[model samples]
Target: MASNTGNAFDFNLFKRLLKYTNPYKGTFYFVGVAAVLLSFFSVLRPYLLQVTIDDAIMPSDNEGLVFYVALMLGVLLLEVISQFLFIYYANWLGQEVVRDLRVNLFEHMLKFKMKYFDKSAVGRLVTRAVSDIETISSIFSQGLFMIISDLLKMLVVLGFMFYKSWQLTLLVLTVLPFIIYATRVFQKKMKVAFEDVRNQVADLNTFVQERITGMKIVQLFTREKAEYEKFKGINDKHRKAWVKTVWYNSIFFPIAEMSTSITIGLIVWFGGLRAIENDSLSLGVIIMFIELSQMLFRPLRQIADKFNTLQMGMVAANRVFGILDTRSFISDEGSREVGKLNGKIEFKDVHFSYVDDEEVLKGVSFKANPGETVAIVGATGAGKSTVINLLNRFYEIDSGQILVDDIDIKDVKLKSLRSQIAVVLQNVFLFADTIMSNITLDHPDITEEDVITAAKQIGIHEFINTLPNGYHYNVKERGVMLSSGQRQLISFLRAYVSNPSILVLDEATSSVDSYSEQLIQDATDKITEGRTSIVIAHRLATIKKADKIIVMDAGRIVEIGNHEQLLQQKDGYYKKLYEVQFMAEESLRS
Candidate 1:
């Protein structure tokens, strides 16, 4: 996360934000014109009142008074229309900009490397995508145009006051320096308060989202009381952040009101004393100055509040731009668009790490020939999963080359390379959608008939048919509706339907029951018939029939041969792993 510690009114950042309005330039210009028209209309009414008092009402001219009153009403109607258009178009433009910004932000996040997500919090990103962008919208709808419109109205009102009487206008000016100094102090304090408010909002959202997502864990471990305490602490911080803004508002508004009232009193006192002695200063002029004083001071008072809106928007824009400017995505510079790949893969001197100076794979090299099944066995944290992740370019390698069909994988287009491979993991993730939708992922090319055909081939068709609505059955979030075994079967069937040239199964059968294990094995046998396959598993019995087995320790391969060949070696890694681990499990199951 980035913190903004500079001036609140950042023009460069503001200029960058304005670029989003380029798409709706016509609306932007229309809103600007409406603001200007509103300012002009706002001042015309008070001038008409001055004229009606001096030129029509006092002289007892009935016809002149009627004409002037009618003109004043007409100006009021125009001002109302202008206000409506200004508000409507400004908000419409704000929503349009927000819609575009949200789309662009989402698309940018989708391309980021998996490593970036590994270090970032899900809820903070959600806050940026949703809540922060919403704050930026206020910049257009309330902050920018509203402030401009108010300032213009003040300027026009001041011009009319001075034209009527310089003496009265200077009296109004006498109180402004104090109000302006208070407003500046208020703005500086509010900027810091708003930044704190935004930070607290992100923290509250992150805490609540994580707790809700893992609610079962909280309850299962009897941690409800502890989690509630943590939540209360966070919620209290959020409340305190908002209260600071309210505190500043309470202090500032009263000062603004006092100054305006005193200025109005002075104008009346001075103008009244002059009107009684001389014919030059008339009663109409005094009344006009009173109305004009409010017109000028009211905006000055409200402008500080609107300026705070702009400050908050700038803070949000800074955070959003931080994410947008990140250079964490995999470089998709490959131009090779090979339609379909032949399933031959080789890792040559692959050295990689998730973090600097902490290598997970050190000069690890292996090759799986076309249409061969290679099983990789290793202990936890032994670089088994890192190999699969590297193959898919989820993260770039520090140094080495991964080749598919003798062409370097880095030279192949990312989507083209990934489309040829499929993976089914130990933990299956299914959306809160229909089973068929989860399987096809709404690929547009895949149909219900195709899914059913693939399901039957994988031997899970009977199981799916037993459920209500069959393929249409909703699998809720993370497939909680189904048992662990049933979810694994869905994942296996999903991988089979993709029909990739290479399939990687990472402990796909480890946690399931006997029935699902048998079904997954059947699906694995059917799917890996002619395609190149790489299986990573802890259960040695499952991979006993694999054409080749690679035993890894620490970060390097220590053994490579057929199952029997590796088992025949005296005190070998695989032989000890099999005898000490799966042999006991197999006996217990029997």
Candidate 2:
């Protein structure tokens, strides 16, 4: 939601953007050289016009006329070539810069702590990475290098005008200060407009993305009209934001055109009088001044427009840099390489809060010895999930010591620590890819054969083979192609193939059919045989055989024991929870 309200020309931001071009320096310099040549060739055309009229046509010299005409044609050809190079190379540099920037932005987002994503919207980030970065490409393709070429052309034209007649040149330039004042006002207004446009665009994208993602909910709840109204409101805001920019352009461009006309009128009037009064000012010189005046002032007009592009690019850079400057990365200071951990996890006196003062886990502690299956049961908001998040270091605990194999997890390399753990969430997510790819996740070392072997081990191989294309079947987005139980089965196969030292299944079988639940339970048994496993479930019956059971209530550990021991404790928290949260499942089983 941050808006850029800085100066119209932020040289600091511009300098930062230039650094991205370091990788494409050769193309960058080629574009620069092309701009210079383009300016030189452009200025040559007007000068040749003057020579053809004054020294060749006026003198009735056929030979001189032919030579000057041929020279003019050659200049035009060179200009065309330079223009092509300038356009092509500038665009090439723009594309390369944005490609690198988009990649860097995505990579940076990947390293952000889960807490950052918890507060951020997917659509807003997508806008930054896709649309805002694409707008930046125009800063080079249509803004920076074009501005340079225009300024150079203006300079060359001005030198020629002064060489011919400084008095006339000075006269034509009297309108320049007013034009500059107008352009400055336009740039400031456009910058604000552009910032609003970007913000509104992000809002629209976020709204549309969220609404479409939850379309089923909208239809099921019969809220289509309400959702449509909300979308229309956001769409209106986006439209209005764009209209403001167009309104500014509508005002600024006409003023620029009027200024240009005034300058041209001054040249024709003053140059004609001077030529009539004194033969020293030739007709060719007067004609050349008219053309040269346009050459000088046209760039100033185009610059007003290009400066808008530059300002928009700077605003986008500010937003993107804001994300890049975030210090929310989970610190990976641990140097211990966890090639293989013993899978012993102990959380000693841990406390955590997603928000500043509202703690979710309050001084809770537990230990899961290697090769043990620990089941955690609680009400919905009792922080069962927070424990899983902290164990994986997804969110750092406020005050705690989380140790794996006696070494604090904080002292282990992040990749090494995570590499040894596999998690299957209750809501399994599958990519829009073949089942094989979904299982292997494009892991370089996980082959199709390996995926098939793991699937067979988890007892889902036959189920997968029954599908249309077997393992090659596309699961589609979020694995919507498969039933919830089937997706859970695929998730289990995915974890099994990784061969992690520890496995975490957070309510992995909560919403599946009885048949799928039995299959999942079968797979769960095989997968957890010799590994440290953490099972978070609402079904007391499913976890009745767990090595240990931890009961939680309102962010506190209320009871801890094996299932039978906790169940035997009359009025114990686990017993009460089983009666409240799992009696229906127990009845269904009966």
> What does candidate 2's lDDT look like per residue over 371-486, in tens digits?
99999988889999988898899998899899999999999989999989999888888999999898888899999888888888888888999999999998888888899999
- What are the per-residue Cα lDDT tens digits for candidate 1 across 526-579? 888899999996555558868889899998899999988988999999899888
CA lDDT of each candidate?
0.89, 0.88
Checking candidate 2 for backbone clashes, the offending pairs are none
Per-prediction tally of clashes: 0, 0
Ten contiguous residues with the weakest lDDT in model 1: 1-10
What candidate 1 gets wrong by more than 4 Å, as runs, is 1-6, 60-63
Minimal lDDT window, size 10, model 2? 1-10
Q: Which candidate wins on lDDT?
A: 1
Query: lDDT at 65 for candidate 2?
Result: 97
How far is 101's C-alpha from truth in model 1 (Å)? 0.6
Whole-model alpha-carbon lDDT for candidate 2: 0.88
